[model samples]
Target chain A: MPFKAINILLLPLLLLGVMVGVWSYIALKIPGFPTPSEVWSELFVVLSDPLYNNGAGDQGIALQLGNSLARVFGGFAIAIAVGVPVGLLIGMSKSAYTAFNPYIQILKPVSPLAWLPLALFVFKEVNTTAIFVIFITSIWPIIINTALGVRSVSEDYLNVARVLQLTPFEKVFQIILPVAVPFIFTGMRLSLGIAWLVIVAAEMLTGGVGIGFWIWDEYNNLNYAHIIIGIILIGVIGYILDTVMGLIADFFDYRKRGRV
Target chain B: MSLKTFLKIDHVDKVFPLGGGKEYVALRDVELEIRENEIVSIIGHSGCGKSTILNLIAGLDTISKGTILLENKHILSPGPERAVVFQNHSLLPWLTVYQNIEMAVKKVLGSTLSASEIRDHVMKYISMVNLDHAKDKYPGEISGGMKQRVGIARALSIQPKVLLMDEPFGALDSLTRANLQDHLMRIQMQTGNTVIIITHDVDEAVLLSDRVIMMTNGPEATIGEILDVNLPRPRKRLELQHNEEYLRCREAIIEFLYSKFAKDDE
Candidate 1:
């Protein structure tokens, strides 16, 4: 094989091998750490019957993953349903932007964990608190990005709408929505990533039937191998969710597709 | 050739507020009367408020002083009656050529026409601009000339009373500009719609207009002269190249622009 092509093909595997070597060395040095093989074996055991039901507290990996995804999607949908219209209003009117910008600026930088106490106090239920955390974490990116998108719409397009004498509703649906699609999808993609991240953290705190809770439970039991497995699964799921959103963003990006 | 005044711009002035209690006068005492089916071209150097005039007539910009009336009614705001073909051929990049034309047609005539009628109306203008094969292509996929053709098609599809063009072919190359100018002439001849074109090209102003309204330089630009283009209709581009009347009209506009209101830098 040519040197460059071989470098491209072998570099990632080489890196992975080095990582595994380092991990194994760390396991040998540490008393309670799981080795690569131990985690691999535990992953197989967990994957063997992922949907296995063992009552409320001891569900299989697949069911836990399902629970995490359900909470993330539920909170993310509600965030979208509220964020987009509020973003449009803020973006369209200068007054609304001025009125709301202070709150957005103050609230946006706050960590989702910071909201957990307040959410738990208000919601009381563990499930609602977890979902609230996801909602609060994800909503800011969506609102800000959507507003930016709407604001960045070319004046030429709006001039076209005005000259055409399109009704206000028609202007929104036909012109603004179409032009803002890429921006909206961009916001959604960011929010989805944040939602996935926040859901795991929230579930860990709330103690639910999710992957985060499963990891916590494994830690309490001193099953370091299962903890390693759970960490890998979370990373993989987060990567898959981001990739799916990227695909959707590409599909709707008229500028990239050159259809617009 | 006196005819009924189809549109009137009476002593119109435009002042843009620059904040801090200061203002900029873009145009002042700009008066004009456009007869029915008349093709008028406004020509000037850059920053001369020629486009400001077109925008005022199209109701895209509000007049600071005086009134603009079309068909004996005040032109208050932008409406379907004055369809503007913008300088950059602002075709919605996301929409196909057919869809772009169909959008204007559906918006203007959807209430009065059947679905098939609307489709036919859109297709007629699309074919009028000789863009039948390109109807399915997006604006990004087409050449500049083709995009301009679609812009014209979209504007004409509405069957507007006055077709307002703001340097419509300014972005195209010379050959493409000539091609669109000819296409515009042919379409105007067929449709008999009143047109007001803003141009920097002297030949274009002479070739396309019945009267070329020349403007002075800006900050307070006003009509310096109006050259009557008495060149006959159904004029051929190749034939008119050596024609005396065409040369005369072209020369008059050139003299007015270069000699009468020549820029300080020139």
Candidate 2:
């Protein structure tokens, strides 16, 4: 990074550190307030434990985390497979757009949690319902972004495509897909966040082996420390997933097309 | 059977159905013939559908009441035979300059050409538009003029028979427009492809065309006059900007436009 930009960036971080330091000092003054050391100890146990750390009852932390990842990744991947093509189809043809957008509009506002009861009854399996929740939440962003990208393809590009006698398949691949990448990535990033959110909610309802169920179970057990651990873990995991997505998005956004 | 009359547009009319069940005529009774190696320009006020005529020839849009013929064949769909360079430089933002042209070649000439051949063709065309150094840069990274060059390169790479340009330089600043006009005229001469350009700029119409077809404004648009540019070939901007014929043609167009158009007619 340039010195100027780096300095500009550091200014905020320094301010944040000072603010956090002051907050921590003020927090320590309060009676019955748990210090950072206490939080750290609680966090350590969850991070290192083989059992009962932040698991879904008897299930281990590693196993539950793995299960959550699987459901999230699985549902997210499926959403991309279904959402992007559908988005493109929705974005491209006039008739397709007319039909598809209404359905998307209806689905967009309906919370993924609302679908939990249906998913539980229809799926009759804990893991499937959890995956279904992720699917419901993640699919919208991918579809909406893909549609926006495809729809927003420049008129000049279309003219060039038409004049060049580009096959519809070639037009989609060569013209539409590339133009739509930024939008697709935006959707994917959104979908990943949604996947995490919906999966957690679904886990609570389905009572399955994931972080969400573990968090709820800790509350039932009256272990506030374990509950805090579960909450911190959720935030940490969510941040990491979002950061990774942002990096991927930035990579494509900065990557240029042909000369000029 | 002469190559001169490679493209013929006959009695074209376009009408748009407006609000309240009425209609607006965008173009009416338009007829034109462009030769294999000539540059024909259409000039008019805004909304006269000069671009519409070019669109009809390019087959981007259908003419409501007449047919457009290219190479003695009726134009029903867009083909590689005629390439259009639009006013906006429509470089796909995701693709680099090289890929934009390569896409044209790859899509149109894919079955006939290999990868190396496609690269060679695109590279040659990109360089032809003086964009060789920027071939790897995407559209967002480039200047607007450079993007338009990519548009031109993509069009020319196909070796199109007739080039349809709709105010290709209208979006450009004066300096870039003049520079590209020189490049375009030279390219047109070298390739000997017939070109029909639509523009509202009188100087541009006078500078680039062999003959200027003047279009009048309207709710119902039609040609006001056709003025032959008798100015000598390979014009210098500074010289021609002050030439007598150039001034005469400009004056005639201005008079026709102000007298006939510039009105609020229902």
TM for every model, in the order presented, reads: 0.97, 0.88
Runs off by more than 4 Å, candidate 1: A1-9, A258-260
Model 1 chain A is weakest, by summed lDDT over 10 consecutive residues, at A251-260
Q: Tell me model 2's lDDT, rounded to 2 decimals.
A: 0.82
Best by lDDT: 1
Ten contiguous residues minimizing lDDT sum, candidate 2 chain A: A251-260
Report every candidate's CA lDDT.
0.90, 0.82
State iRMS for model 2: 3.2
Steric clashes per prediction: 2, 12
In model 2, the runs with Cα more than 4 Å from the true position are A1-37, A50-56, A254-260, B1-4, B241-243, B259-266
Q: Write the per-residue lDDT of candidate 2 for residues B1-266, one digit (tens) a residue.
A: 14467778788899888999999899989887777688889988888889888888888887799888877799987888788887887776767788778877877787899889888889989878888899988888888888888888888888888888889999889999988999898787677777889988888888888889988786678887888888877788888867999999888877777776665553
DockQ of 2: 0.53
Each candidate's root-mean-square deviation in Å?
1.7, 3.9
What fraction of native interface contacts does model 2 preserve?
Answer: 0.81
lDDT of 2 by residue, A1-260 (tens): 55797888899999978866875686579754445556668777766764554433667666777778899998898888899889999899889989888888999999999988898899888888878788889999998999999988888678778888777998898778877888899999988987887777778777768887877777777655666667767788999999999888877763532222
